[model samples]
Target: MNFILYAVPFFVVLIVLELIVDRWRGVSNYRLADAINSLSTGVLSTTTGLLTKGVGLVTYAFALKHLAVIELSAESAWVWVFAFVLYDLCYYWLHRMGHERNILWAAHSVHHQSEDYNLSTALRQTSTGFLLSWIFYLPMAVLGVPLLVFVSVAALNLLYQFWVHTRHIPKLGWFEWFFVTPSNHRAHHAQNALYMDRNYGGVFIVWDRLFGTYQEEDDNDPAIFGVTTPLASWNPLWANMQFYAQLWNDARRAESLWDKLRIWFMRTGWRPADVAAKYPMAKPDLSQFRKFEVPLDGRQQLYVALQFGVYVALGSYLMNLADSLPTAALVLGWGAVAFGLFAQGAALENRPWAFRLELLRLALNLPLVWLAPLAGLWPASAVAWVGLLSYSLFSVIGLYCCRNRITRLAS
Candidate 1:
């Protein structure tokens, strides 16, 4: 049940294999800091997945309670095959819309913040994408394509995308016309004008080709990576909220109510006429832009990588514990979930709120510890509760140290 125990090893295997191929081929689109940041953010996404998907699943369950839909046990292989294609079609539109609309881009831009594209880039997923993304696939539920079929195919589509993030793969000849090969996907990840807002495919390039969003990777021009408004730091939390915070500020500063509401749905970089007057720009020159590389203060990179490992261990343990716990079990599980969000937010924000979240960890767990005895799970309950309490205290002290260091730096 410890998915990361196996998943981490598997990722390591793939990463090592990718390293060998890149070195042998004299191809590298990798930077150590970026790789660490991408991997750290991805592992955090997995840690927080239940929250993202949990909200949608609950809403759908309540809304569809009248109907016995979303069921699937024994699906045909061909059903899965068809589901993969169908899901990709849905994803293509969702992805394209993410670029066209400002709010959606807030969720999707997390993937594009990476300057260096490599295996690690594929791991960079947006946890908040579930906000509106699940709505796009509801049509499948409406059509009665059982939940199992949809989920399996969606997972497979994800697996297929992992291999395409590399910079080493050339166009696969005629396969370029059909599947989402590296060349095509590379264009999707590019920030170049010719490449932006194009190639929005998940598994098949056919969607992009048919949608008129297709743009070939031009060897002469070369691709410039990252977004129009770059994320200056390597923090995953900042990566997720950079656009969102910008939009919030814009809305707050807008002159009228209409401008406030419209600012969120406007085209990717479009601003209100008044706002545009203050912030003019020239065309982006790819050659003049700084090289796409990771930004890490060496030690911060190591600290984050280690924190990623701890989260993997903690999340895996919680998954197993959640499966068997009685009603009381869920209390601790939710506590763990809150703690996860707080831990990530603290590292990402490192502000006053971060300290508040850390302090609340003990209060969150006290109920779980109190109820465990009534469930008659003494030994296991005792150990986990004690461990969690100790960890919370340690985190509190750690935050205090960080706060002191910041105070000293400011003084």
Candidate 2:
């Protein structure tokens, strides 16, 4: 049923609510550029995963499809509860490993690159995590937990983790000892040393507390979020490529054959001996690092809130149209829209090139959407062409207005 797709409605609502409430502290890191950039990366990650889903379908059909392997125990609700608990336990391990192992970290680091955490942070999920994550749930499938229960609990496990990404909440007294609270998770999101790699639970802090991996959110030690290596550039493709490219360079520069092969699985930050001394590791000075604060005017939050809502609505409608029309419709029409959004984000970030690109989309929308969709001036689909033409016309005009403003500001 594509629950992830269905979840977009709730996501839209949450982002809009986040805006209307105007949460500066929570939305502190939220910026228009960050939102647009992270989302562009997110869209690319999702597109990449769709290419990977074929691999999943084959694995499920050939290897894991047999129904006989699953046995749902009918005797107790306690089993359902146990499945939920175990899922979090698995999640804790996977989350911990993602931080500890550089190979996995490449895929996982995309989520952490955002200097600011917000509703966009929630969407910043790694589409590539599907590679290893599904394995953790096999025990549930093996134990005969109904796929239905397994999926419901998995969804709940995921949904529960969403609210914890913010800076809004404070420490709950003993609640920290049990469930994963927002306070506990803020510590997880912090770039500070002591907080790094601690608090790995998805829904239950008890797993972390029980495992002795827990740390409290220190009011004294605030979070300086984002990776040690910056995602300073705004390109979405570059954001996904950043860590992997770093790893690739390290492997190439390694002094020995053993070092080259060992790099990926080594304790994530490890480097070859000569390289280490040359690039001698600076012990991270916590004293020099301070918590990140958003310098934006309060009204920019209003701009972010309004524009983000508009994008989500636009994305949602495009998706719905994809479903209503033929597969060709989705590939040709929806894909064009997504590509255009990415192109638009790239244009906005590149000051020298932005206005020209904006003008191009403004000019081409009718040719791209209308003439392209309705088979070009054939009388049969003239009405369909009109609807598309109208949308293209509005979009072109809008782009022209934005272009005019950019030119004014530059001069």
Candidate 3:
């Protein structure tokens, strides 16, 4: 079962509650564009996972079947408890390596690109993590943990992490020493020198403490969220591709063959000597740091928010029927969703072409609604057509109303 799917409503509620807390405290921890971009990456990740998750599941099943040394029963309570603990241990190393290695960081950096640390940041996950993340849990399969137990524990570990992304909660006295909490997890998200690469645990803070990786949240030196090399864009597609694009350019510029090959596996942020000397990248001074922002008028904001809502609703629908959908339908649905998110990001950035692209997307939806059923994207039903037509019509009206406000910003 997809536990995350069931938890979506709760996640939305808590995010709203967090917003309320933010207003009450007069702390601006969330920005509309940043939050939307964070969620855009998250929705993209979920949609992408539908096609990629088989990589991990297939490999784990293969390992469990051909290489298991013992058979563990899923029915035992002790097995569930033990698997949960052991999964955290495996996760610690995966999470650590994701920061320490360049190749892994290429995938993991998506989560850290958000300048603001909030509950939405927790949802900003790596879509490509399935490629290598499964290797960390092979031990569980070899040690005979049942597949059901492994999957359940993994989901539970992830769900437990959602609440820790907030600044509203303080250190919970003695509880801080054992399990992961908001305070310590905040340190993990920090880009500050003192907090960089610390607190890698998912559920238990014990792993970090035991492994000498733990660092207490220092009140004097507060946490600064986001990576040193800022994403600096609201585009969800660019957010995922930013690091890999950098690595690719660096690899192409390197003079030596060994430097080209080794660049990918080197420590995170390590560049070739030649590339470093010629194409220098400067790290921002944290003392003078400012969050990335693009101004949008009220009309534009409402239009973006309404359109984002539509995509979120569609994304949820895609997630629900992902398993049952045909490959062609899934790919088409994902492409449409991805394009919608890209357009929304462009709108947020106040790009000159954003308004036209959005108009095109809305116009295309009319034909897509009718054509989709014929292509096996959805069943031919009046309800689906009417629902989609109404959505497109309303969205077009909103876009039309926001035209002057949106276009003037780019001017």
Candidate 4:
């Protein structure tokens, strides 16, 4: 019943179509490194959810069992209607708090790190959101909303938000008043002084309007996407950990115990005076802003794209097999994904160690193909074996052919 899985092909197709439109229209909303980093964080989030999702599910189930006041039926059309609206209401608070608070923002900031506003940026999600996101929806469980209805509405809400991440869609006038559209959502994503911390709705913008947090997109002031503290690296792991690491460092440097304890729960961007003075974080001046970029030839771009495609395939396969796979198998699959993403990030950054790490990934895959079936990590199929071999062979040959180009560029 996971609609996102079923919608994955359509998402891929639409992203491709969007890219084509972007190129044709002379609007450069898709940067190779940024898009890859966005999708990599998304892939990491989805893969990590396979393991951490139990926390949310178990808590919801427990609450529903003991705390339910009235049992809601999924079979009722009215129940579906109510659940859909209620879910969004709950989501509004979660979304608002995610931006307003420090610890939650640490997890939520992954989505805002992308400098470009495009379809890929929609997929850029936080892997750690499961740690606290489920807490917001306990109300639904307490009110006796059926688990089936809750899950369905949650997926629908998420799918509804996907199209709003595009730059191609302009405001839809009256529709803009009720729902979250590309224009208003873009304002929400902006770091502009006028646009920051406004429009915190997912499927519905009414919540923001009601709560006095809504900001309409302005013609004079263009939206500048990305967080105030830029995530300069292409690495997804680093992107997720960046804010949390900053919070941890600030906490450690605090002279007062109360300051150390309160710094985390305080407003997002609030720092102790001593910590702020000692380590003044450079906030980007939006008037003189520039998107992060790396010099890479077309060959390197193609190679990174191909490798990312492979990871996407593997990630899809792992998701399909997630429930059936043993714990160790899931861990191995997740590790492979992390490694691929890490090495690719390095390659995009033009790091000298990237080439060696990529080679190591391919070499490691050979043994994985041999051992996976026995470990029940992968199926024992001749075609699967051949496919892995073919991929490894071609990747090595591709790297070899592109060696001089990579070296010359690095030099």
Tens-place lDDT per residue, model 2, 1-411, is 556668766766876677655564343446677776667666655545544554534443333346337555636698789878877887888888898988778878888877776677767766567776665555555556665566567778877877776665678788888889888887887788889888988888888888789999888888777777767755666677787887788888878999898888888788888667666646446567543333333333343334334445545554444435444444454354455554555553454665566556556655655555553222247575676567656655655565566457659
TM-score (all chains, Cα) for each model? 0.77, 0.79, 0.97, 0.97
RMSD of 3: 1.4
Model 3 poorest 10 in a row by lDDT: 401-410
Looking at model 1, report the run of 10 residues with the lowest lDDT sum.
Answer: 294-303
Model 4 Cα RMSD, 1 decimal? 1.4
lDDT of each residue in 1-411, candidate 1, tens digit only: 333334556667787888999899897767666775676567556645644556656544443444545543335676566667788998898989999999999999999888888888888878678888877776656545565566666777777888888887887899989988888888888988789899998888898889798888889767777887877665666777889998887777667789889988888876677656665545557677885443333433344455455655655654556446454444444445445544544444344465565556545556656655566334455577877677657656665666566567669
| Rank by lDDT (best first) | 3, 4, 1, 2
Question: Candidate 3, 88: how far from true, in Å?
Answer: 0.7
Candidate 4 Cα deviation (angstroms), residue 311: 0.4
Error of 3 at 311 (Å): 1.2
- Write model 4 residue lDDT over 329-367, tens digit each, in one string: 888888889889999999899887888988999999888
- In order, the Cα lDDT scores of the candidates are 0.70, 0.66, 0.93, 0.92
Tell me how candidate 4 scores on lDDT.
Answer: 0.92
TM-score of 3: 0.97
How good is model 4 by TM-score? 0.97
RMSD of each: 5.3, 4.7, 1.4, 1.4
Query: Alpha-carbon error at 163 in model 3, in Å?
Result: 0.6
Model 2 lDDT on a 0 to 1 scale: 0.66
lDDT for 75 (candidate 2) = 60
Clashing pairs in 3: none
Candidate 4's clash total is 0
